[model samples]
Target: MALGLFWATVCLCVFVAVLSLDIMGFFSRGNKFQVEGRTVILTGGSYGMGKEVAKLLSQRGANLIIVARNVDKLKAAIEYAKSHAKNPSTQRFHYISADVCSEAENERLLKEATEWNNGKIPEIVWANAGSSTPMMWLESSIETQKQQMDMNYWATAYLAHKTLKAWLYPQTPYSPREKSAKAEAPRHFIMTSSAICFYSFTGYNPYGPAKWAMRGLCDGLRQEVLLYNGARRSTKKTGQEPAPFDINIQMVFPGNMKTPGHELENLTKPPITFILEKDDPEQTELAAATAAIKGLEAGNYYTSTNWLCDVMRISALGGNPRDNIIKDTVGQWLTSIVWLFVGPDLDGKVWNWGKKEGMPELKPEKRIAR
Candidate 1:
């Protein structure tokens, strides 16, 4: 019995070491964006991955507008950027305390950003605010589920729509003609979605549905933006009346993250208690989770080191992915029977940190006729 226990402890240690190595590999290959003099807004920037992204953009001299529900946290984040930013002149930062889940708050936040910039619209907007309910299939509370849906689905959709509409309308001092002349500069709307969108999980009751909805919303909007912009460009070529806007939308499907909220102690409470036990081998897996979460949270899959390359490829290509492509191709399943009998595949589709190389390049392709 003593020998068996010793071997078990050794095996667990080895497994953890391997997991840490895999996660570290992803971080080494992370794609860092160099943006300067560009206006970028990030929701949930008060802490965790959002704050890190703000710090990154600040370092690159990008004007930042950080949003979160906490006013104090937002202020602190703004202060941090002010202190850490390299070229403060090139990076003007602002903060707006609002809930991304509320439509009124979304409109108010965008309006505030524009107003703060003297009516100049932001060139890059990242819809990165999200809340999760990691409850078992049956244990999720009504309030938790509703909040997740609001933050994860409706809030994302509302903010995306508002941001796109604002981007489409020509701003003051820059008329439609001036904007059209600079066609090469694509306006970006980066949606922070999730990889669970590609597959279902027994542990994800409400959160999965909301995230899946975000994927659908992104796909639909992606097609619309392409169609809208394509028609405008075609009209310009024919010397006819041109359509209004040229917008490029990018959707991101983040995996597990290591935000403060994702702490194992917090997750082991209330809603998440059923899904995660303190004694589980993967119970306190923060580094792996951070790799997955930070990847999508960074506004691109490559940012997460390479865990979500497949989803990013589909988003950039502007093509509808067949349902269950990730699940079928990668074999990710989280059904009750599977979870109970097979246990979580810590290294499979749920946590693929090395697949970033397979992501499709972001080269622009000629638009196909509708």
Candidate 2:
């Protein structure tokens, strides 16, 4: 009877151990970053994908500071975002009319975010402002190209720089309670790049290179964050306290969306460009915003509304995060091969129809009735 009791006790201990591990696994699966109550400073937040993101974050109870160049548009966007807020009485919606591309403006934006709400700094920063003019590299001016780069690449870099500096520069030793609080609140930076950063079509000269630079910037930022993680782990392994750094990075490569920027870009696009998007299902600004939010909730490093677009990024896989390791490796090579064939066909379209029609700078072309 004593022997029987000993065996039963062993079985009970095993069962308890298994149950504990399962519970730990559930919480450690992945970081689910929710936007609720987090201060989110979104650039280009007045229109297009930015506007939609504001609405979604507002509904989720995020305190917002929308940055844009236009005051009138900012006011309208503020009203729109507030109306969608889960609790308008409590949610803070403020607008900063500043050109985020400028260095001074970017710095000021960060200062405001830190000082807002009685010294509560922003936990989430969304670099979602960019515009591209549809012109071949040879046809585009150097100044216009530089301006585009300022908006697309420089703005993203500025925001990342500010947030990373803010985190790393203020590394402080915390008490047990402070350490627990730090572990609970992680910082997130999401930058909006373009799928063209991976694969470019014809007439995407200046824009393609500018967006490609954004991807490069994101890669560098994420790698630096990983380095911080490595140092923290190394310190902890040495039985010393790790430096306080808990940050996550996400790069968004969005496809076409129905926004003012999209419409304006389409006005100057080649006929082949129109042909390419004709078959794809309609995607709106809200849809793109929804995908971004969902990606954040899922803790994905790369996010996009279109599956093909996401696959294209992984397929390129230069410095991008792998999808699922083995699955992503296979998918990358397979998709790369398929694109090898599709790419040349697209090149043919460029060679065949390379006319620049419907440019607003030039007079409208007269169309004859059939």
What lDDT would each prediction earn against the true structure?
0.62, 0.76
Q: Candidate 2's residue-wise lDDT over 177-274, tens digit each?
A: 12432554667898999888988776577688889998887888888788776765563465444446578888887887877787778766655667
Q: What local lDDT does model 2 show for residue 286? A: 92
Q: When superposed on Cα atoms, how far off is each prediction in RMSD?
A: 14.9, 9.6
Per-model TM-score versus the true fold: 0.65, 0.81
Count clashing pairs, candidate 2: 0
How well does candidate 1 match the true structure in TM-score terms? 0.65
**What is the lDDT, from 0 to 100, of the residue 52 in candidate 2?**
95
lDDT score, candidate 2, position 345: 76
Residue 148, candidate 2: alpha-carbon lDDT: 78
Error of 2 at 192 (Å): 0.2
